[model samples]
Target: MTSLTCDVAVIGAGTAGLAAERNARKHGARTLLIDPEFAGTTCATVGCMPSKLLIAAARAAHQARESDLFGIRTGPVEVDGPAVMARLRRERDRFVSATRKDFDALPEGTRIRARARFDGLAGRLSGGQARLILDDERVVTARAVVIATGSAPMVPGPFAALGDLALTNETLFDLPDLPRSLAVIGGGAIGLELAQALARLGVSVTLFDSGTRLGGVRCDRIHATLKKAMAEEMTLRLGVTPEPSKDGRAERIAWEDGEATFDRVLVAAGRPPNVAGLGLETTGLRLDDHGMPEVDPRTMQCGDAPIFMAGDANGARPVLHEASAEGAIAGRNAVAWPAVVPSRRKTPFTITFTDPPLVSIGEDPDDSAAIGSADYGNQGRARVEGRNRGLARLYAAAPDGRLIGADLFCPGADHLGHLLVWAMEAGQTATDLLTRPTYHPTLEEGLRGALRQICRAVPLELPGDSDPGQPPGL
Candidate 1:
């Protein structure tokens, strides 16, 4: 058996693993990056980039169809399913290639192409070092370890029984052409985005979720607005668990009341961490009910041990930015070992890429927080753009009027969410933002309107009314 030694051994070569290896090397630690498949990051290969490409094509078709609203009469917008898939695959491969080039540029002997498992017996003999046994019987002993093995899509038993009739994000983009009809299970970000995109592309889509809410939006008003908008575009079966079974060559999904057949069923339920095969039982760490180690979010450490877990492997935050941030923290601390320092995390921000997108930033509002809202239906810009549907809510702490968080389901929400989170991180109050310049007839005016409402509810000792040029002490 071959033997290898390194200061840090990083398992998996996805987004988190790559960041961990790079940061560990930058911190002057000898590192080995191990992965059986050297495919690029999930974002480039499957998760973010390819999904966005598909959404962009859907947006084009949707815009062409909706052009009549702007008084511009247009011919029928026909979607070429094969051509769409061709472009998505072409662009997705280019992104994957770019990431592979980065891997190729790494120093020789830095990457190990094999599956690694913790050597249970060696953990007792190697002092504080982590012992990993590769698939080829090679042994790796490292001073510290980073588990960034990432995650896989969860397919429930019913869907899995259908075999190739079921699809997840990892296999969704590889379709030869768009299906004639699709049943999207789970109304989270992945299901909502793909379901809407496919519907715009002329596919008959029906979305089902056992939960009533979609995209994790907590605000009842915002969720209602989103549900109304989505219902107009496709079928929605909320609060129902679907059972999938084979109907000849097609797939049938049935709930208590009704059933429908589709060319394929997309299972977007959830993705659990890839920790089962890593032999955590050998690590002597206390694992939770889900078999995940007790990890410190600030330090990315597993208890007081030299082992660290980051990114999707930890299942804390599965988004790309959070994965990258956790990887950096785990890598730097792995090198520092017993003297690990805590990292300050960024304000929480998430956006669902559905039409009239859903955005949530910072913390969800508590009952004690002052609430303010703006209806896009009356916003001048939104009305003019023919997208005058949705809502925006801003939350602020009482007395101080400081911005705490916001949930937006309106036009230009992706951009609006970023601006609001930046202001919150900068410690700016709702009244403070109202004093800033807001251009007329723009989506930002909606934000300003909400801020003004927030200023009215919170007890701020302002110079005058929340709006400018108003009487003092009004």
Candidate 2:
């Protein structure tokens, strides 16, 4: 067996692993990056990029079909499934190729295309560092190791029996042709996004969610609105417990309320961390209930070992941006060794790219929080655009009027989500937000309306009616 040595070893070549490897190299450490699959980050390859491509196509088709609402008559619009899939593959392959090129451009021999496992405490090197045994029978020794193995979709035992008949995020993008009818299991981001996209594309989609709400929208009003909107587009079966069975080429799934036979089944169940076969015992670290290494999220460091866990493997925050931040922290701490420094976290923000996208940032709205709200039914920009339905509710600390959270189900929610994220990060108060300039007849004005309510709720001393300096209206 060949033997190699490096100052740091990063497992996995996805977003988090790449970030860790780059940062470790920048810190003057000889870093080795290993993965059976090269570049092709999850976002670009299977998760975000390809899915958005499909969503974009569906959006164009939907708009064309709905043009009559704007007094513009467009004849029957048809979506060519094969052509859409072809375009998706062409564009997706190009993105993957670009990522591969970038990875190849890195210093020669720095990346190893093989699966690796820890050699355990009993097999430590002379310097007391951990060893990694590559699938190719190569042994690697490193002073510091970062596990960024990422995650894989979890398929329950029943669904696993269906084999090729079942689809997950990892396999859905690779489909040869769109199914005539589909049954989407789970109502999380992946499930809801794909279900709606398919329904818009003229597929008979029946969505089943074991949960009481759709897409995890905790606010009752927002959940109801989203449910109504989605219902208008397709069949939504919430609070369902599904029993799936395979019938040759066709699949039959039955829930408590009803049953249906779908041409294909797409499981959007949660992803479990890819921790299997990593030999956790060898790392001298204790595993959590989820079988993942116990590590402090702030430092991304495991117990007292030189090992660190980042990205989906850590199971802290599964979003790509959060994974990148954790990866940077792990990379830095790996190099610094005994003196690990904590990293500042970004304000929490999540968005689901559906029509009138759903967004939630920072703390979730609750009863204890002061509420400020605005409806888009009368917003000028929304009315002019002919897409005026949804609401924005901002939550502030009751005592100090600090902008703490926001939940929005409105047009242009993606932009609104980012704005709220920045406000929370900067510790801006409701009063401070109102001071910012807002243009007329814009979606942002809806945000201004909410802030105004918050300012009105706070007992700010205004000019008295008897004061001569007060304006006539005041």
Candidate 3:
């Protein structure tokens, strides 16, 4: 077998691996990035870009249908499923091509187009080193390793038996035509987003969530609003699990209350880390209950091993931005191993991009000292757009008005979530955010309304609030 050596080896060429490789090189370390499939990043390939493309088309169709409310009538709208899928593929390929260009521009010999597995230790190196066995009969000895293998969509064992009849993110984007009917078997972000999108685009979709709630919104007011909005788009089967069985030439997903057979079953259950066949035993690292490497969340370093796990591979924070941040931490720490430098995690920001999207930011509002809310039913922009169907809640410490958390279920929420994410990260108070100018008749005004509630409820006493238009001393 041919042999190669590097200071660091990064497994997987997805977002996390690429970030890790770039940061390791920045730190003056010789790095080898490895992945069997150099197709593109997951977000570009299937996760985010393609899904959004489908959603955009679906929204256009839904909007056209709903335009009658505004006295704008476009009659007899028909959806051509095959044509829609074709356009989706074409646009998705452009994004994938762009990502591939970024990968191709990496320095020569930096990326290896092969799968890798741990091959025990390299005794020759003075410090602890790992031996990586490549599929092409090549070996690499690296002083430190970063596992960024990303993840795969989690399909239940029974669903796996359906083969081509069942679809996950890995296979969903590749379909040449849309299915007539679909059973979406998870009520998380992916499931709800796709279910609603497909339903809007003329596909019959039934969404089932085993849990009592949908998304992660803990507020009853917001959750009820989201559930109502999504229910109008697709059949909702909340607090129920579907029993799956394969019948001749058809698949059936039956629940206690009802049953349905569909042309396809889309599983948005969860993602399992791509840890299989990596030979973690050879690296002397024990896998956690989730079959993920037990790595420090801040450092991304695997336990007691000269290795690190980042991004979806660690199975903690799986979003694109979080993956990138984790990759940088893992990369830097891998280069400066034995002496650890941990980084502080940023304030958590997660958004589910269904219509009137669900957003979770910062701390848990359920445990907050005080909670305040704004109902979008009265917001000007929402009323003008005929989408006034959600609410925004702000959590803060009472008496001090320190912003702790914020949740929203409102139109244009993806953008709205970012504002709160920044504010909470910068330690802005509810009253402080209220001082910022809010554009009249915009969705952002809803944030101002929510902040005002928090300010009123907590009543933070600022020096100037006692006497308006006068200096505090005067």
Candidate 4:
């Protein structure tokens, strides 16, 4: 049997694993990256990039259909399903190819295209090294190991019985053409985005979730607004648990009150960590009931061992940027070993790329003094563009009116979320933000209006009365 040794060995070559491997090498440690398939990252290959490509196409078709509201009449907005899928695949391949190039550019002999598992018998050696058994019968020992194997989509048993009729994000983009009708089985970010995109692409979409909430939105006002906007496009069956069964060539989704048949079911159910076959029992570390090691978010270390867990595998923050940051921390600590230092994490930010996107940044204070809100129903830009149909709320701490968190379900939410996150991170207060100039007929005006509301509630003393009269272009 072949044997290999390295200072750091990273398992799984996804975003987190790649970041860990790169950072370990940057720290002057001999690092090895292992993955059964070095195709690309989850984001580029299946998660973000490809999904966005489909959303982009759907946006184009939607805009064309809605152009009539702007006093411009157009012919029937026809979406060529095959053509859309073709472009999505073409562009998605480019992204995947780029990621593969990055993997190929790694130092020769450092990238191993093999599956690896912990050596159950050896565990951790007395020298603080861990042994890994590769699929090719090669044994590798490393001073520190980082597990970034990522996660896999969870398909319930009933849906699994439907065979190929059930699709997950990993396989949805491979469809040659869009299905006639689709039932999305989750109301989180993935389900909301794909259901809307498919609906806009002329597919009959019915979205179901056991809970009434959509996208895990914290604010009730934002949830209500988002649900209304989404309902205008497709059927939303919230607060219902659906049972899937075979109905000839199609799938039948029956709930407490109603039953419907769809060409296919898109399972946006949560993805658990892909840790089943990694042989974690052999790691000589304590594992939780779910087989996850207790990882320190600040240090990314698994217990006191020289092993680390990052990204989705840890089930902390599953976002791409968070995964990358955690991987870096794990990699650096893996190289530093016993002298690992804790790293600070960024403000929590999440966005669902729906029509009027849903975004949440930072944590909502438990005892918020005031909540500033803006309604898009009559916002100048929203009314002018004929695309506005949502709400935005900014939370403030008591007394000082410090901007603590924000939940937005409105146009330019993606941009507004970033701005609010930066402001919160910089410790900006409501009165402090109100001092900034807001452009005329822009989405920032909505944020400014919300900030003004906060100032009113807290009665903060400012350099000048920032709550000026709203003029058309002022």
**How many residue pairs clash per model?**
0, 1, 0, 0
lDDT of each: 0.89, 0.84, 0.85, 0.90
lDDT per residue (tens digit) for residues 335-378 in model 4: 99878999988888998999888899887567646888888778
- C-alpha RMSD (angstroms) for model 2: 3.5
Q: Show the lowest summed lDDT stretch of 10 residues, model 4.
A: 465-474
Candidate 2: segments with Cα more than 4 A from true spot: 122-127, 365-367, 460-474
lDDT string for model 1 (168-227, tens) is 999999998999999999999999999999999999999999999989989999999999
* Pairs of residues clashing in candidate 2: 120-282
The residue-by-residue lDDT of candidate 2 on 207-287, one tens digit each, is 888887887886888888888888888888888888899988999999887888999999998888899999887676777
Q: What TM-score quantifies how close candidate 3 is to the native fold? A: 0.94
- Which residue pairs clash within candidate 1? none
Writing each residue's lDDT as its tens digit, candidate 3 over 107-135 gives 99998999999988654235778999999
lDDT for residue 327 in candidate 3, whole number 0-100? 91
lDDT of 3 at 84: 89
Q: Better model by TM-score, 3 or 4?
A: 4
Q: What is the overall TM-score of model 2 with all chains considered together? A: 0.94
Q: TM-score per candidate, in order?
A: 0.96, 0.94, 0.94, 0.96
Better of 1 and 3 by TM-score: 1
